[model samples]
Structure formats: C-alpha cells, structure tokens
Target chain A: MALAADPMAPIAARVARVRRELKDVWTIDIEVGSGGFPFAPGQFNMLYSFGVGEAAISISGDPARPNTLVHTVRAVGKVSGALTRLKPGEFVGLRGPFGAGWPIDVAVGSDVVLVAGGLGLAPLRPALYRLLATRENYGRIVLLCGARSPRDILFRIELERWRRRLDIDIEVTVDHAAPDWRGNVGVVTTLIGRAAFDRHHTVAMVCGPEIMMRFAASELVNAGVSDEAIYLSMERNMKCAIGHCGHCQFGGDFICKDGPVLTYRHLRDRLARSEI
Target chain B: MDMVQSDERSILTRAGLDALIGTLAARGYRVVGPKLRDQAIIYDDIAGVGDLPAGWTDEQDGGHYRLEQRDDNALFGYAVGPHSWKKYLHPPRLQLWSAKREETGFSISHEPETIPPFAFIGVRACEIQAIAIQDRVFLEGPHVDPHYQVRRAGAFIVAVNCGKAGGTCFCVSMGTGPCAKSGFDIALTELLPGTSEPIYVAEAGSEKGAEILSSLPGRAAQPAEIEAAEAVVTHTAAAMGRSLETAGIRDLLMSNLNHPRWDDVAERCLACANCTMVCPTCFCTSVEDASDLSGEEASRSRRWDSCFTMDFSFIHGGSVRASTKSRYRQWMTHKLATWIDQFDTSGCVGCGRCITWCPVGIDLTEEARAIRDAPAQEAKP
Candidate 1:
C-alpha cells in the first residue's frame, strides 16, 4: 500500500544458519525481521549480496514457520557466488516472498506426486514439507527425486527421515553413480513409470531443468496423467519480481507474477518450442 | 474567471502565441517545444514563439527523414518526429537508489527526485496516446515506478493536432491520432488556408490551460472559424499513408505464434533495435548495479532496453528468446497480440516512427498483413 517507499528498498535479513548441501550449493536460513512479509510455499525472494548483484531464490523452508526464511543458492553468477560463501550472522538484502506457489488446496484430497531433478528439489522442498505436515489431508504420497550423481543429493538426512515414514512412498534416482551405490541409476522419467499410483486420482508437481521437465511431463502424459493434474515450476530471467521490469515475460504472462508454478495445460505449448 | 471557463475556444494571432509562452514561464514552468535540430524536430527549451519549428515541415518514410521548407510559416506543420515525451517523463536512465558499505553494515541512499513542472508544447495526438499507454505501464503495474510517476505528475501537456501526415504515419488506423482528443491541458490547431498570416485556434482542456490562455491576447472564435479548425483535423485524418485492420487482430496474432512469417522478417532485420528505440510505447528496461572503482559504493539504475537484444531474456543458462526469429516473434507478438491480453490495448499507437526509423525499411503494417493474408499454413496450429 505504501507506494511512496522505493520498491527497490530491500529489508535486511540476518543469516542464522548456513548448511553446505554439495559442491557450489548451500542452504541459507535467514532471520527475517519482524516486519518481513509472510510467504507461501512456492514463493521466492530476491536475495541481494552487498557489492554483488541479486538473484531470485525460491523459499526452501516450511511456510508454517513464518519468522525465518530459507533459500538454497547455487554459485552460478555474481550474486549466488557471493551467497554460497556467506556465514551465520552476516546480512543480506531481501525483497519478496513473490509468485504463486504449488497448489496445496487443489492437491488436498487427491494423491500427491512430487518429482524434482538436481537443484530443482530446492524450490519444491517447501511444498513437500507442507504436504508432510498435513499427512492425513491427501491420499497416497509419492516423491521421486533425481540428481546428477550420488554425492550431489541434497538434504540427505531429511530424505532419510522421510524414507522412514510408513504413510509415504519415496524413490530417488541418480543419472550416474559409483559401483557401490545400490539404487536406481537412470533418468527421473523412468521412476515415474515405476511409481505405484492410480493415475486418475493423482496430482503431480514437477520442478527441474527445462529439458528434464519437458521429458518428465511427456512421461507423465504417457503414463495416463491428465494435463490439468500435472504442474511445473517454470523459470526465466527475473528482475523485478513484482512484474514491472519486463524481464520475466513468458508470452502474455509475467512468470514472476502470473506464475513460477503453472499447470502443464497452461505452459506445454510454449515449453515445447525450443526458444520460446 | 469566466475567461478560464472549460471548453472555451479562441483565436490567437501568431504574435499572441509568444505571450502564451511568456505566461507559462511567469508561472514558474519551463516551457519546452519542438525545434528543428539535426534535420529533425525535437523537444527542447523554448525562449518564445521564435524558437518553435516555424516555416519547416518534415518528410518521412521507411529508413528516411528529411526537413523541408513550408510555403507558409505554420508552427505545427508536421506530424510527429523521433523524440517523444517519454524522454522527459519516463527518462531513458534513472537511478533508483545507491548503497554504500559502512564500517559494520551498509547504508542505502536514494537520489533526490527533483522534478520541475514542465509545459510540453507541440504534442501530437498519437504521442498523447503513447504517454497514456506508458502511464498504464509505469503507474498501473503492481509496483508503481516512483520516478516515472514523479515526472508524469509534474508534466503539463499542450497537445497539437496534426496538420500534415508523414509518409509513414497511420494514426487514423490506430484511432489514436491525427487529432487531439483528451489527456491534454490545451489543444492547438494551426490553420494555413492560403499562405496568409498564420493564426492558431486554441481550445482549453483544463483549468490551468484556461488560466494561461486568460493572460494571453485572444478573442472568441467565430462559428465558421471553429468549423475550419475541425476541418483541419478531418483533412489530417484522411491523409494518413497507411492503415492496419484492428478487428480480431489480437486473436489472429496470438493464434499464429509459430508462423513462418517471423523467420522471413528475421532474415532482413539486423536486430539493431532502432524500431524499439524510436517507438513511443515500448517500455522494456534492464536494471544494472554499478559499483565505483573502490567497490565500496554502488547504485542500481534502470535503462531503456529492447527485447530484440539477445541478453534481454537471459536466465541462468542462456537467453530465452535466443534466435533472431524468436526475438522478433516475441517483440511483434507482444506488441500486437499478447499486449491485448496484458493491457487490454495495442502496444502500438500507430505513430509509425518505427517504420521511418528502421534501417531495413521493414514496415510492421506490411508484416502484419502478410501474416494475415498468407494462405493458411498447415504447420501453424
């Protein structure tokens, strides 16, 4: 409501916890100020590093706990490169809790299927926590995860704990692995076919590289899932997450405002094209 | 106060126009009007009536612009030029804020926004519509751009009806120009019937415009003179050189997303972005953070950007619209098709500055028509 204030003015957040996920990847938990805005599960934050630029990182923590904000960063660019090296008690600028998150309400009564690839797991982790917290709200829960290799797996301890739960079925695959590894060694779409689920009652949420998402969506389609039942977290160049900068325009929709999470029926045509 | 009444029309002599400029200046407003510079008429500081582009008209076509001498000293003799009101209102470069690293933390400071009230003279009807289109972009968005709002709020518009249509103009087709409608403080019509002394017919559109008109020497317009003023607008509308069909255009463009016509255009397009730069309504921008040599202080600034550039759509891996074919498709589809979906209006005001400024002489009207008239392609679903 305060249009007077500079929308570029970022609120300062203190880094409370920093956990190394893998090579070039880290999970940061920030102590958001009391005035910080509450975010939904799929929303993202523009994390700014002093002397460096900013990056749009999705909220990787639980949404129910409103005080602390969590984001996972890969050291790909100037901002995230600085972010991966940050320590506890350091400060970073934050602006948002932006974009539409996963469809928790729609997936409430139906069976839930979560598919994530590589670092794609970070954005969908919040939705997974929300689903686990309200375990009785949905039918069967199936999580299929894929990483480049065995050592690249994220949140290993948490995945083990979720594996122990009796109500949920979890399968993880690595594109390549060492000789000692004892799990599925193939691309993620293979797991989709093997996962046990009644296709008519299922709601699927997918997040990964664009190519991987395309292949996974095709696999889901081939396996009898309706287009409306499959959703994806899409990403493009994002500048002003509020939709004014014009960086995130995907056709008529600004990916930052209209979606980061959209149904397959909403984006399949655009995604099928090579460079849309 | 009756002199400042709404909808009052008056005839101002060529000399009285100078008084109007002096009156606006006395009210602490910087009066900027169009002047001939570098073979083009552009907005700049005005001293009086002598500073305007008098006795000069422009000839425009694809990839060409030249100034020509008019038979009479008509001030508003030409259609729109390359420079638009956005140069002052939304400005090409603006600093949002600057941050400096302090001893323990960082302190952010914003550059003081100092917007002087400005009286923009010689605004065309299509340019007015262009400004209103930009208003929807900068003001009506979810997060308003504060700097654009500041400059726009301080602007005083004096719109002029087109007296001559350039070779590339198509405002009649867009229904946005060739005549001034609303969104102006005052509307001006320059009449030159037979090379006699030029007289301006002024219509006050706002109380401020009327107040300024009250200070100038003018008289009530005769009924025949009023009809003559309307006739000037009618002639300009009918003289437009090009037209674009608007009915179901949004659907026609949106449905043919992958049409091969884009590739045909891409072969000729250098992607120099001259079209987007000259266009009055294109609002795309890129933000960059610049730190000083010491790397202690930095400011984030937003600059006008074009979608035709490869880097404009860059994400983590590479650009989204990488190919020239895709970039041209994105710009055209967004301007013609998806813009209707987003803004409920066409992005183009039909000024045709793009057609005149494009180096390849690639007219968008011709391109749109080619897409519509091409035999139904089986590949485009």
Candidate 2:
C-alpha cells in the first residue's frame, strides 16, 4: 500500500483573529482552506509555525464552525509562544483534529457531568456548548471546573451565563483564592462530593492532570458510577498522529489512533502499570 | 542430448572473459560485483574482470570476519557483505518532499528521482531473498515508497551460485541460500582451473539474461559443466558450519517475555544501534526539521531511527522503556518474535550481519540459544 501523504504540510491560513480568554491563554481563530475539518470536540491539531516547530493544541471552537477553526493555546513551548505571538495575517500549519473523542451519542439522553481542570476545560467547553444548544436531549447538565487560582478560570463569562440557566449547574473551584474571591475553595473533586447526582444515570467525562483525573474518577466511582460510564481523555507524546509511529502506544493500544478518549473500564488494568 | 561430453561446454578462456568485461563496460551499464575491502568482502563497481577479488575467500563467525587469499583465480568469490541491495534501492536517507513559501501561499513539491539502471554482477541467493523481503516492506505495504519501487524495477540482477559457504552462514536454516536456484536474470557457477573443464555454467533465468548472453561472446554449457555446477552447490550445502533451531522459535520467544536472559544480554549490550544499521530488513525511521539561522523557513527530513534511542518511546514527560534492559528486550523480541505477527515472516534472515557489526560481539543466535536452554523459572508468588 502507498504511504499516506504527509498531513502536516502547512496550509495557507491567515490567523483569522485572536481573542484573549484568560490571563495566560489566547484563542487563535484560523481560516483553513481544507473545508469542514470534521473534528470531534476533544480532538487536537498539531499546530506548526514556519520556523518554530509544532505542538499539539486541542480544537476549541464549535464543531459546526466550518470556515474558522479555533485553538486555545497557552504560552508553554517555542511553538506555542510563536503561535501566541502571531498576528491576524500570519500563517501556521494544521495537521489534524486527530484521535478518538468523547462519545457524544452514547452520552445523549443521560445526565452529564463534565469535570475539567486547568486547560482541560478547553476541550470540554465545546461538548458543553453542544449539549446546552440542544438541552432537551440531556436530562441534567453539570460542569465542575477547577483552576490553579481564581484568575486562572477560563471562559469566566460563559461560566456565569451557564450558571444563570435553570437547566444547568455550574460549580467553579480553585486551588488558591485571591483577596476578593467568593467561590468553592478546594479542588474540583471536593465539589463533586457535595453535588446531588444520580450516579446510575450520569455519564461522567473527566479531563485533567493525571493525578486530578485519578482522584476525580475515584470520587465518581465512589458515588456509584460504573467504570464503563466514566470517560477520560489521555495525553501522550504523540509524534505521528497516526498509528505507524509507535511512540504513543499504551500497552497494546495506540493512544493517537485508537483513542485520546477512552472509558476507564478499557484502560483500568493497563493504566495500573507503573510505567504507563 | 550429450549427457557428459567435455567439449559440449563452450569454454570462455581467461582472455575471452576479460574481453567480455570490456565489452560490457563499453555499454552503459555500471557493473558492480564483490571485492575485498577492510578485511571483509564488499560490493563495488568493477573496471574489468581483474578488479574482481579472484581466488579470495572469507571466514565468517558470530561477530568475526576475516578474508583469506586463495591460490586459484576465481571471479565469484566470498560470502555476503555488510551492505545489501537496499543501500542503492532504499537509501539510508532521501528527500520525500520540499516546500517553498510565496506571497500568496506555500508551494509544496514532491520530486521523486528517476532511478538509473545498473547491473548487479554477483548477487547471492540469500541476498536475493533479502531483496524480496525488502520488496514486501517497501512496495507491498500500504504506502508504496516510490523511490524504492523506481530503483527496484531498474535493477538487473546477476546471481552467483554459492560454491563455498561461510562459517557463520545459516541460510540453510532460513531456507534462503547456498544456491541461486531462482529470482535472478542469469545464474553463474565458476568452474576451477584444475576441474575436468574450465568454463562457467551460465543459465538465463529471464528473457533479459538470454538477450544479454546471446549478445556476449559465450556459448551453451555442456552436460559436464551442468553436473559440475550441481556438485558445487551440494558441496556448499554440506559445508554449512552453523544451524539455527527455527522450530517454534516465534512462540518460544513470545511466551518468555519476562525471561531473565534479556537482562543477562543487556549487561553487555550497548544499545549502540549497530545491529539495526547493518540489518537488511530493519526499517524504523524518524523525522527531523532544519531551518535557516534567521528562522524564517524550515524543511522536515526523515532519517533512519532505531528503537534503541531513548527518545524513540518518549511520552509526555518520560520514556516508556527507560531502562536499557527494556529497550534491548523490545528490539530483540520485536525482531525475532513479534515480527512474525507484523510482517508474516521471521525478521532475522540468519545473515550474521548484525552479529558481525555489533561492537560488543553480542550474538543474537547465542542469546536465542541461551533463552531456549534456560530452565523456566517461576515468578515470585
């Protein structure tokens, strides 16, 4: 079989625009020539700069947004810094919205719980927006968000609007609070213990730091949610977003190809390994 | 037909052979055959028949090789070399794509080179198998590498039947060599001077070979010459010094993943990647990017990569195979064991190139034997 063509070739993308979401994070809206980049909410693109190399950035825009694709990037590495510094007219490379994403269809008709920590919220926000857009399909929509500090919370205005809606519950927490802050004080997992959830009917989706996800999943499990009902988005050093390169293998699974999103039941034993 | 007539074979005198070589050179084909280099047999372009390493033979063992001169003048001499046909066909590094930026947009280009035609003068039977193995990898895979296909299609192979086998050769076990039975345009067996008749038993295995031979100054071999070729192949088969127990090898290695033998070998193994470099079938690679000092534009290039490298399994903040033992185990197991699952054939060709090229002289055959011989130890309850 002929090898697939190189997917990372930079497209002629004008940084359609940029919007500062939080203190450190900025969203760059790009006009991609390849129309309708069909990406699930949790999939990511390997964003590339002409000279600065590339980094994996999650797709943060609405899946319905066809002409413009949005990526919320924090100034972490050389490529991210270059991406954050780009003006509206500059260009960047976009590889894919690769990897398996949240099973939105499976979560339909079920009460939903979105547990997001720090930058993890960026991927979940799209799913939240989609669910809220068609609120009649879901029973109850709850979003539990946590950040390092009060100012670090992303989509603060959106969180406020969601909190005002009668059909949804928005609970925000921070590891540390500033002088004038009034909100949940502990980790996001702490708020989960207080929320009244029908664990049997709820589908929990958790994405965060590894330690945070472990604790959040444990809390969900303790509240009677089966491992099969809990989904987590795994992060790995994925060189090729395809399965050919063995870099992103976890046990027998290629995380880049098989999943960046997998139910806890599928990975419980494999993730228990010391090295994984 | 005459069964064993001495005069039936048309003898190409030494001078006639030289003249034939000159005629070939006058034509466009670059004739590459075997030559003695660096105390080992290596393939090189020959100017004439004199450039051939006549009367030279090599002794090969695990991690050891030495060429010894012979008293008789024979054109096709010595066993396989470190370099396979892959060097010319699937080069170590080649450009796949190039991009140039313009005001409107970026213009990307894929410039695949047209492969040049060349005659391989003395390809061995096992090397032929190696070429076939590479064909499956480069051509039959999901993504056909155009560069390899171009070169492979253009190569004209002249296979030399092995009259003498190397000590380390286990092609017999691998079902590969000791005779160039097929897969060549023309096959040759050189008869020694003291033999009943001095001539080459040449047979055209392809139409191209028949055309080339018809044009050259040589005639049909006699029944006696054909008998002599058979005798030489039988002798070479009987002379095989090493044998591998290939029976149930894939299963044996797979079931013993946690075997202690891996750690024993890892103690001496440097993970230097020499084995992979010399291996004919190993095809793992990585991509690299380079840019001008101004950091305006960059080009990405793919280079040969080895599983031995730490970064090969890097994930997030750490490496999956952080220990040398794990990395070595992964490589050996992948080659000898799991490769059957991936490629539907045993990865090791019993060519002994990895054994000879290894800096620490760690023999894979020996390691396999050790693992096989070791009594199964139960893990702690």
**DockQ metric for all predictions:** 0.55, 0.21
After TM-score superposition, what is the CA distance of residue B377 in candidate 1 from its true location, in Å? 5.2
Model 1 chain B weakest 10-residue run by lDDT? B372-381
- Top TM-score: which candidate number? 1
Q: What docking grade applies to model 2?
A: incorrect
Residues B166-243, model 2: lDDT tens digits: 777777888888787778876777788584333677667777766565555665676777788889988887877677
Clashing pairs in 2: A1-B141, A1-B142, A1-B143, A1-B144, A2-B142, A2-B143, A2-B144, A3-B143, B9-B222
Compute the lDDT of residue B128 as modeled in candidate 2: 83
**TM-scores vs. true structure, each candidate:** 0.96, 0.76
Candidate 1 lDDT tens digits, A100-196: 9999989989998889999889988889889989989999999999999999998878999999999899999999999999998999989999998
Q: Which portions of model 2 miss their true places by more than 4 Å? A: A1-9, A19-26, A40-44, A55-60, A72-76, A96-276, B1-33, B44-52, B71-76, B110-114, B117-144, B158-168, B172-257, B295-297, B374-381
Please give, for residues B21-78, the per-residue lDDT of candidate 1 as tens digits.
Answer: 8878888788899988988998888989999988999888888888999888899888
- Name model 1 segments beyond 4 Å from true: A1-3, B1-5, B375-381
